[model samples]
Structures are given as C-alpha cells and as structure tokens.
Target: MSSLPINPPPRLLMGPGPINADPRVLRAMSAQLIGQYDPAMTDYMTETQALYRQVWATTNEATLLVDGTSRAGIEAAIVSLVKPGDRVLVPVFGRFGHLLVEIAERAGADVHTIETEWGQVFPVSVIANAIARVKPRLLAVVYGDTATTMNQPLDELGEICARHGALFYTDATASLGGNDFAMDAWGLDAATAGLQKCLSGPSGSAPISLSERAVAVIRGRTKVEAGIALETDEASPDVIRSNYFDLGQILDYWGPRRLNHHTEATSMLYGARECARIILAEGRQAVIDRHALAGLAMLAGVQGLGLQVFGDVTHKMNNVVAVEIPAGIDGDRARAALLADFGVEIGTSFGPLAGRVWRIGTMGYNARKDAVLTTLAALENVLRRGGVRAGTSGAGVDAALEVYEG
Candidate 1:
C-alpha cells in the first residue's frame, strides 16, 4: 500500500454538528499534557467545571466534563439516574429522541415514548398528559433534535415533571450555546451537551451538569471500586451497569474528593475548557442572538430561492434549518456540487425525512453573517445548476442580506 499523509482539505462546515471548532479552542488543545492529578491539571478541571456552570446557566455543583463524546454524557446521566425497572418517559421528535429511547432501554428503564410527526414538536399539554399517564421516574427529552431541525419546547415540561415528582433531563448537544437554555430556571435536573456544536470545539468531550436532586439519586447507587474499597467506603448493590459511564464515580473524580477514576482526556479537557471560556467571554445571550440572526438569514435565503422550509418554523432550532428539497432535483447531487465546487458542507435529514430535506446549520464558530450569506450563495448556484428555478441569480443572497441589514 502507498504511504498516505494526513493532510485534509479545508471546508466550511455548516452541518448539524462537528462544525469547525473555534480557533482559540484548537490552540488550547495543543498545550502540553500533565498528570491527571497534577495540581495544574486539577486546577484546569476546576476552572472547566466553573466555566461550564455559566455556559449551562446552572449553578449546579456537579457540572463537569465526561471523557467521551456527547453520547457518553447522555449515557452517564441515564444509566446512573435510571436504575433497572425505573420508568422513563421519552418524547420522541427525531433521530436523537430514538437514541435516548435506546439508551434508556439498555439501562433497563421501563421506557415510554410519546411522539409527534418528524417535522413537529410536542406541545406542553401533550407532554404533560404523557407524564400524568406514565407517571415516570425520569422525563428524558431532546432539547434540539438536529435530525428534524426542530427544538422541542421544554420550559413547561420541567414544572410538569416537578409536579409529578419526576427528574427532568435533556440532551442539548445540538442546541446549547446557540439557543436560550436556562437549566436552572427551567428546573432541568440533568442536562448534557457536546463541545462540537455551539460551543465550537471537537466532539471528544462531553459537558454535563446535574442538579442536587440528580446527584442524590446517583450517589444512592454509587459503588466503590474493589481496589479502593475501605471499611468506611459506601457501596450500593445496584451499582451503575457500566463502570465507564458511572456518573457517581466520575463525580468523585470531579468533586472535592479528587478520587481517581479514569485518566481524563487531557487535550479534550483543554479544548472543552476553552470552549466554555469562549462562550462565557462572549456572553451567552449575545452568542445566542448571533445564532438567531444567522439562522433567520439562512431561512430567508432558502425561501427566497423558492424552496419550502420544513417543520413548524416557530419551533425550529435557531441554529439549524430544514429545507424541503425542490422537485426534480436530486438532494444528494445538489449537496455534492455545493461541497465539490464551493467547499461548503450542509447536512441531510435521517429517518422519515431522509432524502426529503436538506438540513443547513449556522452554529458554533461558523454562525456568522458572512458564513450564512456564502452558504446561501453556494446553495443557489448548486440548485440552479440542478435545473431548479429561482426568481433571480442573486435572490438568495439578496434575501439574506435583507435579514442581516434589518
């Protein structure tokens, strides 16, 4: 076999996730590694947790990083809080919702799901009704499902869960930082997110936070390691199913105990720390406002090209938009042309929406007016080449500019 180098072409990522990380974050990741328990390393970890508390808008003491991808955070929260036979209500809106269902099921949760059409989100009353009926121990939901480009309304669900004595959880991988998420104000007991989305970092680390209530539940099922066991150490027979994903043990690593769990991913920790720092430095609301502006511009541009936007626009995420593919144009062909010619990447939908919609995102470091305009211009060229008619050559850019200018 021929030897190959690691060089990769640069492309503007305007997809659902894994977008370009902020340059500062990439730089931070390049710093030299240190021992897990080194004073400097532990200091970075503490700073990271404190930074994420602001990013997540929660004063939750258990906020910290999970060593794996965003899914690791999701699994840790689920497997730790949801013991075997616990009831979990998952409101399925898109592919990620199904993922929550699968994880909850594997955790031996009595999973119950209420779903709406792929392009739609559940109303508060609908979810409240499900909670009342299922009487679940946990209410797990996806704050933003990139597969549908729709953001489920979550403000009311928290109170509903509280009224029913259920713990509330959400996967914010696709929405956090780019959207208005108040974990504490919304009464979210547990929330998990990735750095790759609005946080503008790579996907190797997951930032998670838990309320005191969730910590209590996790602590109850905590188990001490056989090697580290002592007479005074507390252990539970119902230890978390996956040691790698035990949030209680992970908390010990993050908490004042500074207990050794796993050797943390140092570079990823640096990256995660910088991601949170950038967001906090920028002011969370200002960043969210930027995403809203970029998203609006993209939506207007697509509509100007005479394409129908998918989903209930009001409930759509402020970072990603789903555009229905115009008739007689192959969606993949258009996407390929945009990528090959302009080096801009948009996303495609999955499940029921596969091949039917093109998901375009304006998030993370790419959420900017110029990025939005350029993607629209590129998309218009690709669509036109594919024989899709628009009012004019510059219609997409013009419409987007109108939004930006306004």
Candidate 2:
C-alpha cells in the first residue's frame, strides 16, 4: 500500500461514458452520510426525480432511481414490463438490443428481434413493419449504443409503438445528457438511464421513467404477502416475479408514502441529483448543442486526417465517433502509446468491430474544444509514430478548430 502513488495522472477521458464527473456532483456525494430514511435524503430523492423529468423532458409521475449501474435499470424495466408468455420486440442494431432479448428471455418473455448490421440504423418502416407483424407487448431499444456509437431514431418508432398498443422503452445510458431526447413527445412509455455516461458522474445510480400506461401495467401485476393481508390490502394485481427489480415497489418508495425497500444509496442519489441539476442549470438544449458541435468538430478533424468513419454518418450519435483504425498502424500499440504519453483515453470498438475501429467520445463536460483538440492531437501523434503519413499530426485539430471558428 505504501508503494502505491498518492497522486495519479490528470486523465482526459474521451471515451464512451463514465466520463469526467462534475465537481458539484462529487462535492454533493462528499457530504456526510445520512440515513436513507432521513427526511432530508428523501427530500433529495423527490427533488432528484423532478430534475430527471426535466432532463428527460417529461412529466412522467413514475420517474425514479434504481440502486445499481445502468444495466440494473435496463433489467428492472425489462423484467417488470414483460411477463411469462408476453411478446417483446427488440430492434437489434447493436449490442444493447441483444442484451434486451437476453434479459427478456430470463424474465420469461417470448422475445423477437428485428436485427440489423452493427453499423446500420433500421429504417422507420423496418421497425414499424416488425411491430405490425409481431404485435408485441413491449418494444425495447437502445437510444445510443457505445459499441457502435450510433443513435437510433425514435420519433417515428414511438408513433408506431403507440399505434400497435405496445410499450416503448429505451436505454439512454450513452445519450441522455448530450443528445436531444423528449420522452413524452417521442411517445416513449418507458426509459432507463445512468449518471455515468453523458451525465458526467459515477455508475451506481439508474434513473428511469415510466408512463401512466406502464405504471398501470405493473400495478396490475403487483404481488402480495402470505400473512400481511390483515395489515395491508389485497395482493397487487401486478405481481412481479422478481422482488429486486420490481418497479411497482420502487415507485411506491419514491412516491408520497415512503415505503421501505433497500436503503437508497444516498451518495449516489445526491450524485445523480447534482448531475441532473448541473444539466438543468446549463439548459438541456444548450448541452445537446455543445455535444453536437464538438462531435462535428471531431468528425471534421478525423476526416481531414484522412480517416474513414465506420458507420452511417448522417444518423451518427452526437457524442461518439467511430473510425477505421487505418492500414499499417498497429491499433493496440497506438492506443497504448496515446494513453501512456498523453494521459488520454479513447475506446476501442466491440464484438465484430473490435480491433477494426476506434471509438472516441465527446460527452457531457468533456464535450469541449480542449477535449476534442487534445484527443485529436494525441491520436495523430500516435498514428505518426506508427508510420502514418506526414502532415496529418495536427490536421484533425485544425479541422476541429475550423468548426468552432465558424
């Protein structure tokens, strides 16, 4: 332990999520611990839900936090919403849609997928046609997949889900803060998110929102205790099989009457609240604009340096960009050098795209001129060391600067 360094390098995280945390969120988390049932903590919980609604651009009464990482929220929504024999339609453009199907299968749901290639977005009609054909009870998709660094279109699909009487759920873990998203307007019935991605915070809290229809469905399936009938009311019509991921019980705790569940992670709740508050303070639209501009700058810089992006350019995610690793440059060696020499981190692609592409992100507080410029420069130097063409070292930075200047 004594050999461990007391201080660490100042790292510039330009990768997918768990980006730099906001100082306010850190300080808020640093406050002295309080009992989970403390009135002050619950007050923060209530306020946190409200702030998240603003961040989600929704008035959903059921918006609240789950006590685990972003995956926890995704599981809660899937397990709670889909029961045995119910049909779930997942449009699998990337890893997350696969995850949805895998979880739904465990939850006893009949899963169906309309899968696309890794880098492609399904046409609105593709999803609409799938829903019309499958007539599923639930539709699950990811808003932004870090694996492919792509944002799926929602507006048309939301309307399609509404027409089919199916609930629409999205995992916005990688896009929540930086992208333009409107839960209600998009006709989304449910959505889950995390503070670690674009919110620029840690990974413990899972923020979720459910529409009234979603609430009624879960309320209809609530479970009852064997001997507590005398003390309480009838067994809930909606009995969720999994006690841990049940949203009904979760909503009960966050609602007016604070029901007992797990001791809410107080520091995480404060961290999430501060994350939302900071976004609120900045104005959601402005935050999105910053991500978009920064993304554009990076895109321009990468293109200027003669790199080919991996996927659909027009429908790209605002905070993440994926580019081919370029021929003759040792991908792993370049990434290691960039980190060792520059104290910067950019992500590698996943699954089929792994080793073929590199993913760089401009998300949350890290979506700025310096972050973009620094990442571009570091990458350029790394590529140069790996035998890339001359004169390309600052090409990316110069192109990105041109975007800001304009």
Candidate 3:
C-alpha cells in the first residue's frame, strides 16, 4: 500500500453535524503541543473555561472541558450525579433523548421515560406532569435532537424542574452556540455540548457547565484516584462508577489544586479555546442570528423547490432543516449525486424517518448566504436531474436570495 501526507478533497458539508471547522480553529489546533502540567497549558485551560462561561451564559465555577467527544460530557454528568437505584426522568422526543436514558440506565439508574412522536416536541405541561409523577432525582433531556432537527423548549422546563424539586440537565450539543441558550436565566442545573455543531470546531472536546447543586451531587460520590491519593485523602462511600468520566477528579485537575487525572489533549484544547474565542468575538447573539437567518433561507429555498418539509417547523432548530424525500426519487441516490457532482454533502434520516427525509444543515462557519444558496442550487440540480419537477427554473436559489435581501 502507498502512503501519502493527509490531503483531503474540498467538501462543502451541509450535513446535520460535524460541519466545517472555522479556519481559525484549525490554525489553533496546528500550534505546537505543550506538556499538560506546564504553566502555559494550565493557563490556557483556565482561559478556555472562562470563555465557555460566556458561551453557556452561566457563571458556574464548575464549567470545564471533557477530554472525549460530546457524549463523554453527557456520561460524566449522568454517571457522576446519578447513583445506583436513583430514579431518573427522561423525555424522549428524538434519538439523543433515548441516549440519555441509555446512559442513565447503564449507570444503574432506575430510568423512566416519556416519549412523543418523532417530529413533535414535548409541551411544558406534559413534562411538568411527568416530573410531578416520577419525582425523579434528575430530569434529563436533549435541547436539540439533530435526528429530528427539533429544538426542545428549555426556558420553561427549568422552572418546572425547580418547582418539582428535581435537578434539571440538558444536552445542548446540537443547539448551544447557534440557538438562544441562557443557562442561568433558564435555571439549568447542568448542561453539556459538543464543538462540532455550531461552535465551528472538530468533534473531540465537550464543554460542560454545572450549577452548584449539580456539583454537590457529584461531590457526594467523589473518590480520589489512588495514584495521586494522599494518606488523608477522603473517599466518598458512593464513589462514581467510571474513573475517567468522574467530574470530581476532573474538577480537581481544572481547579486551583491542579491535580493530575488524565493527560490533557493539547491540540483539542487549542481548538476548543479558539472556537469559544471566535464565538465571543463575533458576539454570541450575532452568531445565533446568523444561524437563524441561514436556516430560514434554506427552508424557503426547499419550499420554493416544491419540497415538503418534515416535522413541526415551528419547533425546528436554527441550524438544520429536514426535508421530505420527494415522491418518485431515491433519497440516497439524490444525496449521492449531489456529493459526487457538486462536492456537497447532506444528511440522511435515522430510525423512523429513514428513507423518508433528508437533513440539510447551515451551521457554524458554513451558516451564511453563500453556503445556503450553493447547497440549494446543488440540491435543485440533483432533484431536477432525478425528474422531480421543482417549481420554475432557478426557483430555489431565487427563493434563498429573497431571504438574504429581506
């Protein structure tokens, strides 16, 4: 086999996630690596935490990065705060919601779930009623499920959880930077998100925030790693199940104590830090507005092409749109043609929506007028080639252009 230096072809990623990384983030990742314990590295870690505080819109002192992907952050939050036999309430509106239930169950929680149909989001009243009945220790849900492109309303759910005496948690991996998220105002006890979606970075690090109440729960189950334990180190009777995902020890590493847990991933730290810097520099609200504008344009373009959208558009996320596969066209083949001919990529459905819908995203660095118009133009060409009559010639691009003009 022949080997060569990594040089991948240019691709316009219009998929639901892992969108193109911001060039600034890529450049940051290319910097020279430093020892994890070095003063410079520790300083970068602290600065990154501060930056993410602004991103999450919270003053939580427990905000930090989880070494692995976004799921690692979710696992850390669930396993550290949820103990065996504890009751957990999960509302499943999409695939990610089921993931929360699975992670909680694997951590030995007695998980109870309430589910809505694939395209619909749960109403605040229904979730409130479930909380009152289950009265679980924690209420875990997904803020945005890419599987459905639905943004679950979190503003009111926080108050509901507080009234019912339950810790509120959400996975904002798909919605954090691109959507309106107010952690403190919304009364979220804990939140976790990935960098790939709207943060404009690669998918290796997770930014997480924990309220004091959530921190207290994790502390109760804390256990000091034996390798770094002193004679006086205290271990909680109910130690967390996973060593690597333990928030208590991770906090120590990021906290003033500067204890060692796992070796920090330096390049990912650089990428994550730059991602936050980019968000704040652009103004978080402005970035979210950009995503909203792009999403609207994409929607209008698809509708102009005479394509019926999937799910409840009213609850759709600002970063992605789901369009129904037109009648008499092979959904996968069309997507394949778009990629092969136009160097563009979109997403396919999962589970129930499989073979029924296509997901196109406008997120992060790619959430712009140019990206939206290009993707719509490519899609229109592909559909027309497949014999699906779009309205008039160039209707899709014209429709998207109208959005930008307005």
Candidate 4:
C-alpha cells in the first residue's frame, strides 16, 4: 500500500457511543509521552483519581482507571470481587446487562438473571424479590443500556442489596457524566465507566470506583505477580484468575505504592485525565444538565418528524434516543444516507430492535444545540428523500429550535 497521510472525513457522531471527543481531550492525548514511573505521570494519575471521584459523585479512595475499554473495567470489577462458585444476580434490561452475566460467568460466578422486555426496565421490587430468593453474593446491573435507550433506576436497589447482604455493582459506561449517577450516595459497591460517552473522550480508559466493602473483597483475592513478588508475599487459593484484570494489583499500581503493573497507556491516561478535568471544570451536574437538554431537543425533533419514540420515555437515558423507523423508509438506508450525504452518523439498533429503530445520540462534545439541529435536519431530509410520508418541511428543525430557544 502506498503511504498516505491519515485525513479522515468529518463526521458528527450522533450514535450510541464513541461520540465526538472534546477537542481539549484530543489535545491532551497529543502531549509528549513520559515514563510510567515519572513523578509527573504519578501526579497526573493522582489528579485523575481525584477528578473522577467528583465525576462519579464519590469519595471512595479506590477510584482509578483501567487501561482498556469500558468492558475491561467491568471485567476487572467482576473477576476481582467474585470468586468461583459465588452467586451473582443480574437484572437484564438490555444488552449490557447480558454482558455483565457473561463476564460474571467467565469469572466462575454462578450467574442468575431476571430479564425484562428489551425496551423496559425492571422495577426495584422485582429485583428485590429476586435478591430475596436467590440470596446472591453480588448484584450486577447496567446503569444505562444504549441498545434500548433506557436508564435503569438504581437508587433504591442499593438499599435492597444492603438488606440482602449482596454487593452492588453497576456498569455505567453509557450513562456516566451525562446522566444522574451518585456512586456513593446510591450505595454502589462498584461502578465502572468509559471516557467515550458524556465524558467527551475516547474509549481506551475506564474510570472505576469501588466502595470499601468492594475493595475488601478484592483484597482477599489479591495475588502479587510472580515477577514483582517479595519473599513474604503469599498467594491465596481464591486469588483473581486474570493478572491483567486484577483490581488488587491495579490498586497497588495506582495507590501510593506505585508498584509497576502493565506499562500504563500514557496517552490514554492524558485523555482520561483531561476528560475528567473538563467535566469537573464545567461542573459535573452542569454537563449532565446539558446532555439532558440536548436529549430533549433530539427527542422533540424526532417526534416533530412524526416518528414514534421507542421504549418507556420516562426511563430513557439523557444521552441517546431510540426512534421507531417510519413505515416506508429503511432504517439502515436512512442512516447511510445521513452519513454519506450529510457527514452525520447515527446508529442502528441491536438484538430485538434491529431494523425497527434508529438510535441518535446527543452526547459528549456533540451534545449541543447545533449538533442536535444539524442531525435532525439531515435525518428529516434523508427520510423525505426515502419517500417517508410523515414529516413536514421544517418540522424537525423547528421543534428542536423551540427547545433550545425555550
């Protein structure tokens, strides 16, 4: 292949995730690389931990970054805390909930799940009743499932877990920073999130926080790596199976000890740190409010285009909206047209929702009035070109503008 400079097309990512990264985050990622053991790198790590504590609305000392995608954080939190033969209860509201089940099972957890319809969320009572019967060691669920655009209510579930003596874990990859999530206030034992969504950064780093209870469980399963092991270090039978995903080791690396783990992805650390810094500088709640406002505009815009919003609207996430594909247009075709003709990229659904709905996100750096209006205009034009029978000439844009102006 001939060598060519990498110049990509401009795309407004109005999709579920991996949205447009904030320019500041991009700049941060471009900074000069430094050794992992450098004082500057350690200081950046410490500052990142502090920033994420504010972002996650927690004061937990165990908050740190996992050097992988959001799922890596999920796996780390699961595998470290859950030993083989432990029972893990998962309430499946959408795709990510099933992901938790898969991860837990891989960790040798005896996973049991109660599932609701794809577009709906499980009520607290239902999960509580399941916990009552199953008496699981850990309760895992997704805070937001982008596939269905639903935000699972977790506030009450923590107390329910407390009542049942179960550890509470939530994968907040899709919802963190864009939606209302209080890790400490909600009594969450473990919570993991990615930088992509409302954090306005790439997906390489996962910011995770663990309550003391969760940390204690992970410590029990700690095994110092063979290469770094001291003569006095003892290995336990219940040690975490994966060295790479071991939270105990990761904690040591992130904590004051500064023990070497994997050579930290320096660029991703810069990006993650910058993401948290941007959120904190903007004020966490203010960013969430911005996402909420943008989401409402998108929702109204789609509705004005005479499209039906999917799922329970009250339970929908503040970052993405699912709209039913109009009767006469192809969902994928419309999305492709939006991308090719307008340089705007929307998302299609998964599992049961495939071919039935389109997922448009107003998240990260793209969660703004202009992005929402531009996407809505492009979508309406595409639908009309595809011979859709519903929307008027300026209906979508008007609706969205009204939201912004109101």
Top lDDT model: 3
lDDT of 1 at 83: 85
- Minimum summed lDDT over a 10-residue window in model 1 is located at 226-235
TM-score of each: 0.97, 0.95, 0.97, 0.97
- lDDT digits (tens) for residues 1-406 of candidate 2: 3586588678888888778887888999999998887888888998998999999999999999999999999999988898788999989888888888899998888899988899889888889889999999999999998889889999877888888899999999998988889999999999999988789898999999999999988877766332122333334323576777888788888888777756788889989999999998988898999999999999998888888998998889999999999899888888888999999988887789989999999988799999999988888888887888625557888999999999
- Residues 260-289, model 4: lDDT tens digits: 788899999999999999998998989999
State the lDDT of candidate 1 residue by residue for 10-102, as single tens digits.
899998987988999989999998999899999999999999999999999999999899999999999999988899999998999999999
Question: All candidates: CA RMSD in angstroms?
Answer: 1.8, 2.4, 1.7, 1.6
What would the per-residue lDDT of candidate 3 be over residues 1-406, giving only the tens digit for each residue? 9899899888999999889999999999999999998899999999999999999999999999999999999999999989888899999999899899999999989999999999999999999999999999999999999999999999998888888889999999999999999999999999999999999999999999999999998876776653354344354336687889999999988999887888999999999999999999999999999999999999999999999998999999999999999999999899999999999999997899999899999999999899999999999899989999999999999999999999
Which residue window of length 10 is worst by lDDT in model 2? 224-233
